[model samples]
Target: MLQAIRDTHRYSPGELRTALRFLAPLGLLIGIFVLLPVLGTLAGSLYLDTTFLERRFAWFDNYCGLLTDHTFLQSAWFTLTFAAVSVPLELALGLALALLMNSQVRPLGLLRACVLIPWAIPGAISARTWELIYNYNYGLANALLGGLGIVGEPVNWLGTGAGAFAALVLTDVWRTTPFVAIILLTGLQAIPVELYQQAQVDQAGALGRLRRITLPLLRPIIIVALLFRTIDAVRVFDIIYILTRGGPGGSTTSLSLYAYRNFLGGDFGYGSAASALLFVVALGLSLVYIKMARKLKIKMR
Candidate 1:
């Protein structure tokens, strides 16, 4: 690969132009569907736009409001904590489940399909299902806790601030863990069997081989999964909206939900500012993760 770089003269400007031509349509689509909308929202954030009111440019006043908004701060904290907690849990559980599925466990073979069932159900439907599971009375969660003698009485899973937050986290983990598993499983399968065999011949144990070989080779894929999951987790809405409605003292409201409420309440400027901030946060995290991955790769060399 280093030699190939040194021989870069083999590549021509014609090839570069051909590649650009091929990519032009994709760039155009991104500009139309993504860039243009984002630019529009950023512009909208500068206004005092509201329903039945004269549209006026406020120029960062909306953003300034976010600094003093208690609910906004709480929602932002909830959003960050939710992603911080959920993504790692998903990744860990997913790695385990993926390893199990990829093992010689024939009983787990059916799980390849079963794992996707929760994810396949529409988000709205799944959220409703979880709502029932976390219901204050006669719900599966309460029933199980009662049956196991874990709690003396039914817990208000979705009616209390902390309980509601926990419920959201658990529901999200259950719903999205399968997706992480699938991504890891694909990466797991790509690893050469001979590497493991070689490790075994060297008298390496399962744990040793996994840490030394599997994880190191799978770093790039893991980063990809983390990137995708982190972005999705931050933008989470449908499930939270359906389950808790950002209720129980507004302890579980995510930034996306906050923005949505703003939009629904006809405060387009505030909503746009919230959304633009979310975009910045997500983009910043993505860049950080990518840079960390690159740094790790370099360190490995």
Candidate 2:
């Protein structure tokens, strides 16, 4: 690889230089916005004080403290549970929607565009909208339930512990399911038409085709979408903050919200530690998914 790269560069030095020139700006931007912040966070996590006025190195103390911190543990647990539940739901609904969109239907272009509306809307806006919908008095949720005679009184959707968690999950699902659907739809479109035709000639029904061909082929794309959604769910903050503010006894507080609270409270070191831990958790999850995807790909091959 090294000799090949050297030969290519020797034969086309100008092309190599031009490519480097074009990439320089992107590399600089990533360094400034991504790499530097990550390094700074890692460094800050090792110290007891982030401010230059009172710098004190306390290696791993903040991480150790997190193990015993009830708020941190609770937030971590809730965040994990949230991702675990919401990711699968999003994948299932998204796949179903993708199947629907992939079908031969009237107004296909308009339907595809309409499906993306929820995903195109900002999460903060969606959260606010859902908050209003879930409001106890004069809220759509309560009104609809009452009219259907499901509940005699207005249920405080965001006030109670279970209600707040469910509300957040529902909000997240509505906002992100479209994104998952779009990804799966792309994957679905990439599937070869010839394969389906052959399956039809072989007397394979829809379920058999899906089981043997479609799913196996779509596995990689599904894993990619799942990884994206899982990471997003783990780092979720804006929607939860907007809707519940981790209210009702901190039942819905996510790791990101917990980190933000610590940061705002001037515990920079602790906040950075929490942020670093969140990064690690997200990275760990991504790595696991990548490993599983690679193994699956190998088996498929």
Model 1 lDDT tens row, 10-118: 5589999998999999999999999999999999999999996899999999999997999999999999999999999999998998898889987675878888787
What CA RMSD would you report for each candidate? 2.5, 4.2
Q: After superposing candidate 1 on the true structure, give the runs of residues whose Cα lies further than 4 Å from its correct spot.
A: 1-10
**What digit string (tens of lDDT, one per residue) describes model 2 on residues 39-152?**
999999998974444878999999999889999999999999999989999999999889889999878899888889999998889888898898888799899999999999
Every model's TM-score:
0.93, 0.91
Off-target runs (Cα >4 Å) in candidate 2 are 1-24, 50-53
lDDT of each: 0.89, 0.90
- In model 1, which residue pairs have backbone atoms overlapping below 3 Å? none
